[model samples]
Target: MSGIYIHIPFCKQACHYCDFHFSTSLKKKDQLVFALAKELQLRKDEFKDTTIETIYFGGGTPSVLSTNELQYLIDSVYLNYKVTDHPEITLEANPDDLIINNIDALSISEVQSLYKTKFEELKKTGINRLSIGVQSFHEKDLKLMNRAHNAIEAKRCLETATQYFDNISLDLIYGIPNSTNQEWLENIQTALSFGIPHISSYALTVEPKTALASFIKKGIIDNVDDDLAHDQFHILIDQLNQAGFEHYELSNFAKKGYYSKNNSAYWLGKSYLGIGPSAHSFNGKQRAWNVKNNTIYIKKINQDQLPLEIEILTKNDKYNEFIMTGLRTIWGVSLTEVKKQFGESFLEYLLQQANQYINNQMLCIVDNRLKTTQKGKFLSDGIASDLFKLR
Candidate 1:
């Protein structure tokens, strides 16, 4: 089975730490939507033989689109691709879009009631899942991140959203500057109290050129604490494990029945088609990404050309990826599969590289599969890189 990821590269406002390809302007929204539909049609042949099991609307903020506008693209996917009877359709939304927040104009009950109404309308549009961007519930932290939603919308949206959707995932951020371990614990508790089935939490990294980086450089904001982040990560793991959410992957936790199919497909190396600006698509042998600039992407698509460049994976590239992704999740890298797929040479090289870590107890093998041990989970990426084969 395959999946489709449609990127909506527009946001109501820019988050200070975000470097994702997006614009705060909505002037070209309609044209971009039209172009995305056209792009889908153009790339239909790529997935003609596969049944699409998931369709993810990820972005700057998918909630900016009206139900009808969103549906037009979903309809396009159905019209073009072979789809399963039940497909997981997810929309990534910010709290502000999900709830109409004029707490003064309406009572808390009235405001939350409106959220239910809006979410109900969204549900009817065939979206089976909602991924809420509730970065933080503290007003100070929210202001620090420059997230559009305030503390009220964050809590209010969850309280109301749970009423409409069962397959909900909340995105939370840890390690924000000035956020203490206590505050982080409270955030995790607040999320658990919502009874959300899935959470995709991440550390606050300052990517180059983002406002967070600039702020740190200029001494406007305090730098993030690595020790604090380490402490908070354990707090999350302990609390979530106690709450029965599986730490299925790094930065992700899910209840037994609530794993993210869209994300799981990516980690498991399943084929997926990505449409719109800055979206990436991968067939087994090759990968492609759309142009990052909206104007260029629209222009190229309008001219009947795909704006993305392509990369054909070498055997080494594929092998390295398998090891990296495998080690990140609960599923470890299978030496048996490696030997079968890439031959004994690659497998031997992997075992040779892994010997040191395995001896150190940072990793262990189960049934010939390599996975990170508890002490190594936080540094899985670095470990994975060290084991990469040089061609």
Candidate 2:
């Protein structure tokens, strides 16, 4: 099944470690939404009647938009695309936005609880799922990362959310310099305690040009230790497994039935359309991405041209992509499918390279499906790259 992704390219504020495309300015908000609607209509024929099973509103922060803005955006997609009867529509939001105003809203918050009202409105307008960015539950960690939400807000938001929506996913980051093993375990425990069904966790990396990277260069912040990160990665996997969560992808875990349909579709190589600034789309044979600059993206779409770059996948490119995404998931590459799709030579190349890994106990073949051993999971990307065919 295919999906749609709409990038809301604005945030209330920037987190120190974030490098995603977003602007703190709201001046172009209305124009950007209108432009996204226009882009959606213009590209309607790209997928050409494919039934969309999921529509994800990813971002800077979709929750920053008012109900009216969100409603209009969803309506526009419905008007333009043929959506499935029960599509999974997810919105990525932060915790701070869900809380009532810092003051006396607590009395009102205790009355009907504003978080509940917000979820009701969100669901009424077609948001069926939420991917909340609850990066940490430790006050010190939250402050170090410059996150807007406090630890209490993170806990409250999820606890309150169970009253309305059950299809919720969360994000967690590990291996921060200050996070100890015990602290990381507590973080995962806290998340599990919330009963969230799906979780996507990642090791904190200091991307160049981000504030965290500059702090390290200035000696104001310590650089991340690879060994510590690796230690914590194993800890995360073990903890999740013990908790009965399936380690579905290299960085994602889920309860049996709560795997992310949108993300799963991506790993399985299904087609999806991405709308709005800095979004990427892949339709099996080609990939396209919109401009990262919000102003430029809005201007181009307002003038009736999609601000995107297209790449037609070569045979090698396609094969490498399959290997890269396939090897990361629990569902590894199928030798039979590879042979049928790519031909005997490429399949032979895979089998040849896989021999060493197989012999070394890093890769295993069960019923013609090649999967990574538990030890190889952490180094999956490197192994996949080693097996890739050269042009």
Candidate 3:
């Protein structure tokens, strides 16, 4: 099944480690929403034959928008696309927007009590799932990361969110400098305590030109500890598995029936349309990405021209993508798929490359699918890179 990803390119404030496209100013917020609706209408024919099973509202910070604004966009999707009867509509939001202010300072939080009203409102608007960005549950860590919400808001949001929605996911960050193994475990423990069915965790990466990167360059911040992150990754794996969660993807864990449909579809290479600035779209053979500049994107959309770059995927490109994505998921890379799509030469090339990893117990051929072992899970990307077909 296909999906629709509408990027709400606005944020209340910037996070230090973030590099996603967003505008702090909402001066053009109304115009941007209208443009997004128009873009949906324009791109509807791109996937005319496919039925949309998921609508993911990812963003600079979707919670920054009003509930009515979110509903307006959902209505636009319904009006323009062939969505399924019960689509999994998700909103990516930060904890602060979902909870009352300064919930972390007080011993008792009324933030959760206030959440009932917001959750009910969102439920009425057809948002079936929430992906809360609860990066950490430690106040010091929150401040270090320049997060708008504190530790208590992170916990408070989930305490209430779980009451209203069962299909929820939380995002956590690991590998921040000085965050010890004990601290990271505590973060995991705190996350599990919230009873969230799904979690998407990632190591703290220093993206070029980001505030974190700049801070590091200026010696204001220490670089990420790779060894510590490695340790924490394994800890996360063991803990989540012990807690009965499936290590479905490299960065995601979920209980049965709670995996993210939008992300799953993407990993499976299913078609999806991405609307808004700096968003990317893929339709199997070709990929398109909208312009990063908000003003440029708006101007082009206003003139009925899509301001984006397109790339036609060659055989090598497609095969490499399949390898990268396939290796990350439990599904693994299929030998049959390689032979069927890319010929014997490529299949042989893959098998020959995978042999080393397989021999080392880092990868193995189970039912003809080349899957990674627990030892290779943390190093999956590097292993996958070594197996890439050079074009």
Candidate 4:
């Protein structure tokens, strides 16, 4: 089965640490939506024979779109592609946008479209899943992160969404400056108390050009310590493990049978299509990414040309990608799959490098699969890089 990811590139405000492709302004949203619809039609051949099992609307904030806007886009995909009967459709939303009582003013009719629309009517649009961005449950941390919603709103929105949707996932950020290990544990427990079936939590990283980066440079905000992040990551893993969650991907945890099918397909190297600015698509042998600039994306798409760049993966490229993605999850790398897919010579090369790691107890062999030890999980990125095959 295949998957589709559509990025909505608008946000009410920018988060201090976020580097995602989102605009604080909404000037081009109407044109951008139309452009994305056109792009979906143009790329229909990309997923030709594959049945789409997941359709994710991720972004600056997908909930920002009105029900009619979202339906128009979803309708385009169904008209052009063969999708599963009960595909998992998810929208990345911010808590502030979800309070049912506040949508009257924020409704899509604000666009005063050639046609009228209302954002509050989204539930009727067949969008089956909601992934809310509830970064912290503490007001102090919310202020530090400059999130649009307070701690009360964060929890309140979850309660509200539960009334309409069952497939809900909450996004949480850990390792914020001045947040002690105990506080982090409390955060994990708070999330578990919500009884949401899925979670996608990540360690806070200070990317370049973000306000966090500049504040740290100016001594106004303390930088994130890798050691602290590592320590808290351990706390996170242990707490979630005890709560009966599966550490499926590196940062994602899910209850039994509730793992994110869309993300799992990504790590498994399944073919998928992505539409919108800064979106990426993969087809096993080649990868493509749309332009990161919103203005340029709209301009190019208006001309009936996709603003994307493509790369054909070489054998070495494919091999390195496998090691990097494979080792991060609970599923270890399989030697049999490697030997069959990458050839005997390459398999031999892998064994030679892996021997040292196995002997050092950083990795172990179980059922002919090469898996990481507890000590190896934190340094997984470094190990995966060492095992790369150079061209």
- Model 4 misplacement above 4 A: 100-120
Q: At residue 162, what lDDT does model 2 achieve?
A: 69
TM-score of each: 0.98, 0.97, 0.96, 0.93
In model 3, the runs with Cα more than 4 Å from the true position are: 102-114
lDDT by residue (1-391, candidate 4, tens digit) is: 9999999999998899999999989999999999999999999987888899999999989988877799999999999999899998888999888764444466465433311222236556778788899988988888888898988888877765776677889998888998888888888888888788888888899999999999999998888988888898888889888989888878888889888889888888788899999999988899999999999999999999999999999999988888788887778788898999999998899888888888888778788888888777877778888888996
Q: Which candidate achieves the best TM-score against the true structure? A: 1
Candidate 2's C-alpha runs over 4 A off are 103-113
lDDT of 2 by residue, 237-298 (tens): 99999989999999999999999999999999999999999899999889999999988998
Check candidate 4 and list the clashing pairs: none
Error of 1 at 225 (Å): 1.9
lDDT of 3 by residue, 1-391 (tens): 7999999999888889999999899998988988998899888899889899999999899888889999999999999878899999999999888876745665444654566678899999999999999899888778878998888778878887888998999999999898999999999999999889999999999999898999999998889999999999999999999999999999999999999999999889999999999999999999999999889989999999998899999999999999999999989999999999999999999999989998899999899899999989988999999999988
Indicate whether candidate 1 or candidate 3 has the larger lDDT: 1
Candidates by lDDT, descending order: 1, 3, 2, 4
**What is the per-residue lDDT of model 1 for residues 367-389, given as tens digits with 9 covering 90 to 100?**
88899998888889999999998
Indicate the worst ten consecutive residues by lDDT in candidate 1: 99-108
The model with the greater lDDT, 1 or 4, is 1
Off by over 4 Å in 1: 106-113
Worst 10 residues of 4 by lDDT: 111-120
Model 3: colliding residue pairs: none
